[model samples]
Target: MRFKSYWRTTVVAAIFLHFFVCLGLALALPLLDFEGAPIAAQEMEVVDLSEGDDGNADTEKPEPPEVKPPAPEPPAPEKPEPEPEELVLPVEMSPTEAAELDETVAEMQKQEEEAKKRGEDGKDVRPPAPPNQEVGTIISSGMTPDTRGTDFRGTVGVLVDVDAQGKIVGVFLSRKSGRFVVDQIVLNALKTFKFEPALDMNGNPMKTKRLINFPFDGSGPHPFDDDENKRMRAKRELFLRERQQQGNAPAN
Candidate 1:
């Protein structure tokens, strides 16, 4: 009995294993058939590259595009030349007027010739000199040395015109003293001066022009001497003292 039970259990496990193997083979059959089938090739459209769009062969190459040069610019218009204006001639003078003009020109020429002759002769002719004129002498002069002027020295030439009455008619400085003060001093002195009338050949008083020189020497001893200065100082001191005494006495 133990042997028969073992045999029956073994038969039952074998039968179950055989059913599972058959079911696995049945599920795998469609996948194996799909993998073994040959795939069909897809149909492609053919292109004829040797023909153009109209379906004809284009044997000739395309011509290069025509390149024309730029058009020439239009020329500018020329300007017109200006017309010349008409010239007007001067009117002809009458015969009498022309003759008068000629005569006037001749007269001018004649006068010019006479003037030239006179000028040439004048070169040789000496002007008549005043008959034996003598320069006037100074009778009285108001000129005094300038005490205020310091070490200044110069000479002045004065042109003095004397009248017939021994009076100075005009006086002008012919040479400058280089100092305005000196010049003014000299001029003022000359105005106050009296002159002896000039005499002609007939011994009659006559007008005359003369140049007089006035000189100032700063080194001279008129006011700058030591002795003179001391004397002046003493005099000024005495005057001041006298004035002071008088003022003091006036209190009475």
Candidate 2:
């Protein structure tokens, strides 16, 4: 009986030890320090951000700005003040006076119609000529440059005459030369020119043309007729008389 008790005790002790050791190991394992576990990856659904067919997002959009209220219309402008009515004198209408007024108005209308017709037809009218105040002509002095080296010089005058018709009726040199070439040149030069008709004392239209003179200097060809020689001699005698008078006068 003693030996059987001892074996039973030993087996019980072994089982108890084994149970306590397991318990202690479980508790110690909890106390041991270890690194923290890695974080777990979470699953998220992917979404595309492309524009929709409607060109607007499926979600509600933000509200738009509110429109401002329109300004009140301005009051209509005040009507302009009525003009004061003119006072009219009451008079009995006379047949004779009415007839005279109608005749005067008709005459005025006829004159206006005639003027219009003339203007449209471009006729029965003439432009007023430019005013002529008689600008003097250029007269050549009796001097020739020695460079022209001529034996004689001729004096010529352009006699311009104005007519009542305001036309250039005549243009001739008071003294004529047989030289056709020189005469023609002088005539042609004058012909090319035009002048505004001068006004007479009565302010009526009068034709006027310029007269130019080329004084005979002691150069160029001296083609003089008998009449011209006589006139020249007379001019010389007059010049001599003037000179003698001047010589007799006392010096001022």
Candidate 3:
């Protein structure tokens, strides 16, 4: 009976201890949860405790090394636009035309030597009339220089030499236009002039001389025209347009 009493007492003590310990555990769990909530979460930072040159432990995260935006890359250099190509125009005169002129000049020189040797300079003769009332035309209707950049504009007097067949042999500039280029142009045009030969006072076609004025001013067109001159005029118009595109002046 004594032993049984002892065992019962021991069991009662164990039950009370278990109940109190369980209650304490339950209370502790709620306190732990409340203290350790997300709001109370802790962050740890490792700081270097090394002293700075000034002998003070540096704190403040060393100021993050003064970050400045990387300097903007230098703007790309702009490429210069290429210039337009110049226009190439036709040649001034053809080789064939040059050869023909050379031949004509030689024939004219021969005629001059023969005339001088014949002593026919001091003869009495009637001056040749224009082809106006005759059977042919004299001068063309316009003055054509065949080239650009002529520097003379005035009345150019010329002396023409005609052959017995009513053909033009040569032309000489009795009066110049003060510019060599202008004089040459006029001389070339005059070589194309045709007139009725002079009358030997007997109404015969004799080789003689004629004087005519070639005006090349803006006031009016020259009193001469021909197929060759017309062609040169059209070329001149086209040439000026090409010059404008090339940004250049005609050869002086």
* Candidate maximizing lDDT: 1
Per-residue lDDT value at 14 in model 3: 100
Residues 1-252 of candidate 3 have per-residue lDDT tens digits of 344358788999999999999999998887665545456668988665555444354545455587789989999999998764322221345889657655654554444345334346775332223443121223433344443355455777665665566565655555577887777677666544445444342334466554455666644323565432343345444544665766675565
**CA deviation > 4 Å runs, candidate 1:** 1-130, 134-141, 145-148, 219-252
For TM-score, candidate 1 versus 2, the one ahead is 1
Cα lDDT tens digits for candidate 1, 163-208: 7877776665656778788777777656545556665544467887
Q: Which portions of model 2 show Cα errors greater than 4 Å?
A: 1-152, 164-166, 207-211, 215-252
Candidate 1: give the clashing pairs. Answer: none
Superior by TM-score: candidate 1 or candidate 3: 1
Candidate 2 RMSD computed on C-alpha atoms after optimal superposition onto the true structure: 31.0
* lDDT for each residue of candidate 2 in 1-252, tens digit (9 for 90 to 100): 344358788999999999999999999998887877889999988666666434446666667799999999999999999874322221455899656645644554354345335555667332222354322122111122221343335745555565554345655454445565555545554443333344443344455543344444544433222322243345445655666788799999
Backbone clash numbers for all candidates listed? 0, 4, 6
Give Cα distance to truth, residue 131, candidate 2, Å.
20
lDDT of 2: 0.49
Off by over 4 Å in 3: 1-149, 219-252
Q: Positional deviation of 42 in candidate 1, in angstroms?
A: 99
Per-candidate RMSD vs. true structure? 36.3, 31.0, 24.8
